[model samples]
Target: MTVDPPIRLGRAADAAAIAALSRELIEEGLPWTWQPARVLRALQHPETNVAVVDAGDELVGFGIMEYLDTDAYLVLLAVRRSDQRKGRGSALLRWLETAARAAGAERVRLDARRDNAAARSFYNEHGYHEIAIQEGGYHGAVDRIRLEKWLRA
Candidate 1:
């Protein structure tokens, strides 16, 4: 039987791999804004959490969230193509949400590409609600759906 990969805090060494995964899975067809340098910065940020699913030899998934005074923003979440549908993505998201709630965040917010129905459904399945739809929201290139999940009253 295959064991589920464990999720943990990202390290400085994992920045490049995480950035590459973001470029391939999340930022495809868009400008590669989450480069290694930027990812390292987030990893070093005090208010941000970069979580990864370490699959022994490599990282299979990752999620980056920035916690604010009242809420948290899910900057990105993605799993390697070969590792999808195995619950790694959902695990990473849940880990981040738990961290956000512990930090006193009332809600978690994120944006998904409107064309990616799978992602929309995935977030919705995780309790995220559609808050808005913005045309040209993705770097002024694609329509984006904004989603939010309230954590408390």
Candidate 2:
């Protein structure tokens, strides 16, 4: 038997945990573009919303997003390596989508590294479609596939 962690709205204090998880989940250490300080700033930004999944007292996963009147952008979503495939990432994503829809977002957009077949498949399974591909779109880290999903209005 196994237990799943609880997912909830994120707070400022979760910033460090989320940043660490991002570093662990993503390529080669944390990208310079998403240093801890930058993550903290995003969590505190007025337009952004963040959610974290807790493992005992530590956060194991997180998702961050931002929105305007009728549009939203999924800026980041990461899960601890040990916690992958347990539904934490999907929970955070569902929470973010619900939050975005509640905030009047009619559509949500995100970008994923095209080479990451796992990520691309995850998004596709969740109803997101690839809308574009940009060479060096992600700060030149790699080619990017832009994905978007329309919400029921």
- Candidate that scores best on lDDT: 1
Model 1 lDDT per residue over 34-117, tens place: 999999999999999999997778998999999988999999999999999998988898899999999999999999999889
Q: 1-153 in candidate 2: lDDT tens per residue?
A: 544457787887877777776666654422556667888899889999888888888888889899977889998898887888888888788889999999989999998887889888988989999999999776676888999999975
lDDT accuracy of residue 64 in candidate 1:
95
Q: After superposition, how far is residue 77 of candidate 2 from its true place, in Å?
A: 0.4
Evaluate model 1: give its lDDT: 0.94
TM-score of 1: 0.96
Give the clash total for candidate 1. Answer: 0
Mark the regions of model 2 whose C-alpha exceeds 4 Å error after superposition. Answer: 1-5, 27-30
- Cα lDDT over the full model 2: 0.83
